[model samples]
Target: MPREISLCDIKGLVGSELGVSAWFTVDQSMVDSFADATNDHQFIHVDPERAAAETSYGGTIAHGFLTLSLLSAMNFDCLPRVREQQMGINYGFEKVRFMTPVKTGSRVRGRFTMAEARFRGPSMVMTTYAVTVEIENERKPALTARWMTLIQFDPKDRPSET
Candidate 1:
């Protein structure tokens, strides 16, 4: 479950470590499903036998985007929720770097650090997080990204004297 925090508490959290998410396994079935969904049926990602013979990964690997897409679930599992937030939008990433291929059957999880938080207007706040998706037993992370999200809430919910 995500920790709950008030809107007024967001700015205070800037530059702090948010939390690490529960580990998620990236298996062959999941890679195949993602390949089918995105029409990205490249051999390296869908064919374990061929991948082992042809690639340095030694087995099928998950797509970088597939790994990136896990951020939402990872965030939900670890990041704090604003008590007054009615909705949140994936405002997109400032940067993303896929540093390592996540091999099939590997476990991965997200490590998040709050980089910045600022009110966008009376009803919205924008936050930036420095995220790294770490692979179990691996020295290098699967990916690193600077993610941004826009949180929406009623202006009336804003703490008074703002």
Candidate 2:
């Protein structure tokens, strides 16, 4: 479960492992959808038969971006939730590494640790998390990234347009 903490408390939570997310299965449909969305229809990602006969993985695999996109779901499951949070948005990734291919029909989960958190304004908190996407039953993780989220404490506390 996600931890409930105030915006003021985020500074103290840096370097702490928040929690692990529930496993999410990546099926062929998901891979196909991702391929359609990204216009990447590589044989290794969308063609199961050719993948089985030609590739060492022996099956279709999900795109690295597809796996990376699951970060939002993972954060909801096992990260700190700021109390009185009005809204939140992804800031961007500082770093990303696709370590292993995630084969279709495999399950993956994320491990999250607070990397840094700071107050950007009176009602805005900027938090960064070191996230590892682990493949079920696999020795190496599928991907790792530095994920950032901008948490807004109030609806009107947004950046001014100059």
The top-ranked prediction according to TM-score is 1
Once superposed on the true structure, which residue ranges of model 1 sit more than 4 Å away at CA?
A: 160-162
Residue 18 in model 1: lDDT = 87
Worst window of 10 by summed lDDT in candidate 1: 153-162
Judging by lDDT against the true structure, name the best candidate: 1
* lDDT digits (tens) for residues 1-162 of candidate 1: 248999888888899998899999999999999999999999999998999999898899999999999999999999888999999999999999999999999999999999998887899999999999999999999999999999999999876645
Total clashing pairs in model 1: 0
Candidate 2 has an lDDT of 0.87
Per-residue CA lDDT of candidate 2, range 58-103, in tens?
Answer: 8889999999998889888887677768889899999999999999
TM-score of 2: 0.91
